[model samples]
Target: MVERSHKPGPISATTASSLPQAQVNVSDDNSKVTATIPSGDTVEVLLYGATIISWKSNGTENFWVSDAAKLDGSKPVRGGVPVVFPVFGPPPKNHATSSLPQHGFARNSRWEYLGKSTSESASDDSVKMDFGLYSAGLSEEAKKAWPYDFGLVYSVTLTKGELSTILTVRNEGKEGFDFNVLLHTYLRIKDISTTTISGLLGTSYVDKVLDARESTESNSDLRITGETDRVYKSLAQDTTTVVENGSPRFDVVRKNFRDTVIWNPWTEKAKGMGDFEPKTGWREMLCVEVGSVAEWVRVEEGESWEAGQTIKSLV
Candidate 1:
């Protein structure tokens, strides 16, 4: 296991022409930026969908990407934290619903690399990077479906024992538009059945497994028995904890995101998925996503909306 250093200091940046140049690597279709803090916690980001594919600290992998996931850009990679924008799940009930694809085009579309920098906060020595996507650069098919002009800037930060992803969306069009977004985070664990999620007590959720029925969570720590798909709407707090066996695992915190989604496909659904390998991959992963789902958020013309989530390891 990699050990995390609690010492305070910033990592030296490589310089070019008296300016600090961020460490980045590009190969073929994907570009990766690695951020290493002074304490040795490291994060690796793939430019494809601004996805965070790897985060290692204290010698353990904190996130999961499917072994059978396609990296050739043919479809959204089945793991990691996929950026779901403009829509979530299936198309909404509307006249123009047929135009938008599942989870919109943010995941499959290529984003422009905006480079990296150090954090401005006095208490932070983390490294941060930015990526952008503009509707003007989208394909004609995507343009025809959602014609509103927009800009999305995704910022990722790697700090000691933590990783943060922030998304900012600007409506450049003349009229206001409404949309939903999510960070579809797939977290790795030793055993899915032994995991318990806390901090959702008294919150009402829509159980997708129960035909989208509304229900309230009464348990302080939720355990998964079978196939589970739930969306906790209008969250009262911004943090949730995932505990494996009797030990704390990860603490997920979010801002400007009103909903939390917990999902585990279990046996039947896992066997039905071609991208999830080994046929028993469901036992090792869980999806604890934080985002603004359940309702559409409206951004006025020339205005922007910001939301973010941070994952901190407890082990």
Candidate 2:
């Protein structure tokens, strides 16, 4: 066995010789699984949508979940990390995803666990769990909405203070298809008003609240004072940070993702949604989502594409 270290995670997949044991807890009904690394970090994933509802690092929850989130598979979970595939937001009128729901069926559809792998190095012990969502496994209603053979492998890796999520999509059909994918990550914070985002100093973005007009960011450290929803593109750096109360809280770095979406519904907008409980939940969360959305990714027959994000805790 590779001896563990007290130092936090470094957030990269590794190949080790011996198979390290994964500390896991699975629900009796198979709805969720909670896996832990040897260094005391844990991650909880639900089978429905293969969504991660909880990721705890050093006993603190990094991802946020709404108090009114529906976990019974009756509807999509309101918060945390919800996988968006095949489409993002509303569908265009004359498109293959026209008949699909707002963010496609990936978040509402149930997924299957493909199992887990654990490895240990001198630095820490890491566990990577996989989930599968195949076209044949989707509901008939979803199939009829957008018919195309595909396979999605969602992997979650945990090592101390970092949680990395990766998705690999393969086209399993005879013909090529176009799709868009994203991970809607709701990062919990001490307070939204105190949170500031750096590294987007001069990036251009599409302000969705302002009728989706193209705009340029002028702030050196962006702060949210009102309802905000903007899609930032062509970022100067691949690594960005979330600073709360003048302290660096989280560092987010992505691979193969070309766009970053920053969002917070604030007061009036939060009150408008029925699922947004407490009416003040917006003050405790900030969404820094990364994905490929400026243009659709086309996967030819027998071809595959992949993208992912890694979050490091700075607390």
- For each candidate, how many residue pairs have backbone atoms clashing (under 3 Å)? 3, 0
The CA lDDT at 76 in model 2 is: 89
- RMSD from true fold, candidate 2: 7.3
Provide the clash count, candidate 2. Answer: 0
Relative to the unseen true structure, what is the Cα RMSD of model 1?
Answer: 8.0
- lDDT tens digits, residue span 10-111, model 2: 777655644455687779999998998777789999999999999989889999899889998999898899999999999889999999999899999999
- Candidate 1 lDDT, 195-283, residue by residue in tens: 99998999999999999999999999999889999999998989999999978899999888999999989999989999988678889
On lDDT, the candidate that comes out on top is 2
After superposition, candidate 1 runs with Cα above 4 Å error = 1-22, 28-30, 95-98, 119-124
Reference-based TM-score, model 1: 0.89
lDDT of each: 0.85, 0.91
The runs of at least 3 residues in candidate 2 whose Cα sits more than 4 Å from the true structure, single-residue gaps closed, are: 1-21
